[model samples]
Target: MADTITLEVARYRPDRETEPTVEAFEVPLRRDWAVLDGLNHVKDNLDGSLSYRWSCRMGICGSCGMTVNGEPRLTCATFLVDYAPGPVRVEPLANFPVIRDLVVDIGDFMRKLPEVSPWIVRGEGTSVEEGEYLQTPEQLADYSQFSMCINCMLCYSACPVYGLDPEFVGPAAIALAQRYNLDSRDEGADVRMDLLIHPEGIWGCTFVGECTRACPKGVDPAGAIQRYKLTAALQSLKSFVLPRGPR
Candidate 1:
């Protein structure tokens, strides 16, 4: 129960420094304040030059994700008081190029997201006039858990596979693809199969399960990837056994 705590924040200025460096700043350690709040204090009161991304202070925006003490977490959800009477390390997310202090480039994730077509694709003749697609409770349950992903990129930070192989589609995107794939109203599953089955797709996952562990929203990307693997394997077997013509 100390009055203040030291935050060792990472600083990187492309114009000046070739690598990142840590800078310490002491901020009030209120029980109600979160790690994000401490960063805000540093930016507002101490140094305006510090840079990071944040919005909606609530965890829903998922923009405040950072490496807090070597763990990927939503800064808004991580209470500052939990670190107790000492210094806490804050840095940009791992496995991504640091744009600045505690801010990493997310261009890679944005580019890969569309490859899976995370949406509901229906038949060409299907029209809105046909009425909205209705779903039962059971149907909704199939993909409900995956739908919680807020695209925080914490999964990417925690994924060692992505660190080793940046070409991998990563976890959140794959999980989102599965979310729509499981939707009863969606017909894009077949279209996305090629991407998911690619070497950089679901196959890239080694089932380390760090992505699921880092998710604040309870979206289990590892589970989704594993499930997709089984489905893909079965489809491959069926294609091998069945004739090329329509069955």
Candidate 2:
């Protein structure tokens, strides 16, 4: 195994340069050390001007996401030894405005996430004293897979539709909407559907499937979008056939 590996990290200082540039640094290539560790080493030992965002080195914070060799990954989980014997490229996530080195502005995602209302919504006249909304294990399993999203934004980095159309609601938000929609206790599916059924919502997804492949948590946003499309289609059919009266 190589004793050291070179990291070609992207650098962007808006005050000084109009475009981002690459800067290389060499760090120890340890099997236990991740890409985040290498970047930390560069910041601590090599240069102090370098900057990035990271918290909970265990990958829970999802703040350490970056483009590693043209692939979006959580640097905290990407082992440096995996790219041994040569240089590894590290850059800020794609399709987002760069804030600095290895950090991109996620304001767009933050704004869109709340539009879907990822939280559970109770029906009108429901009281908290009505006892906890209990659920069976089977019921919990329905949305549990989609609930694993940590808002990493890696799926956004991989999605082409979002790159082309900034107005698209993107992948994570849609999956999160599904997370709530599938929950048995939630009564806000119709409310969320108003936003999700639009052209910028479920229909925005081209089913390129990159979002699913890029998800670190196995949350299949593509499947969720497809499922929502079918649901929307059926709902449209029902509204046309069943008339305005209650069924």
Which tens-of-lDDT digit does each residue in 1-247 have in candidate 1? 7899999999999999999999999999999999999999999999999999999999999899999999999999999989988699999999999998888999999999999998888876467888878999999999999999999999999999999999999999999999999999998888899888999999989999999999999999999999999999988888889859432
Candidate 1 lDDT score at position 185? 90
Q: How far is candidate 2 from the true structure (C-alpha RMSD, Å)?
A: 1.3
lDDT, each prediction: 0.94, 0.92
C-alpha-based local distance difference test score of model 1: 0.94
User: Mind giving the per-residue lDDT tens digits that candidate 2 earns over 1-247?
Assistant: 9899999999998889999999999999998999999999999999989999999999789899999999999999999988887699999999999988777999999999999999999876467888788999999999999999999999999999999999999999999999999999998988898898889998988899999999999999999999989988888788789889542
Stretches of model 1 off by over 4 angstroms after superposition: none
- Model 2: lDDT to the true structure: 0.92
Q: Give candidate 2's error at residue 168 in angstroms.
A: 0.6
* Candidate 2 positional error at 47, Å: 1.1
* Highest TM-score scorer: 1
Flag regions of model 2 displaced more than 4 Å.
125-128
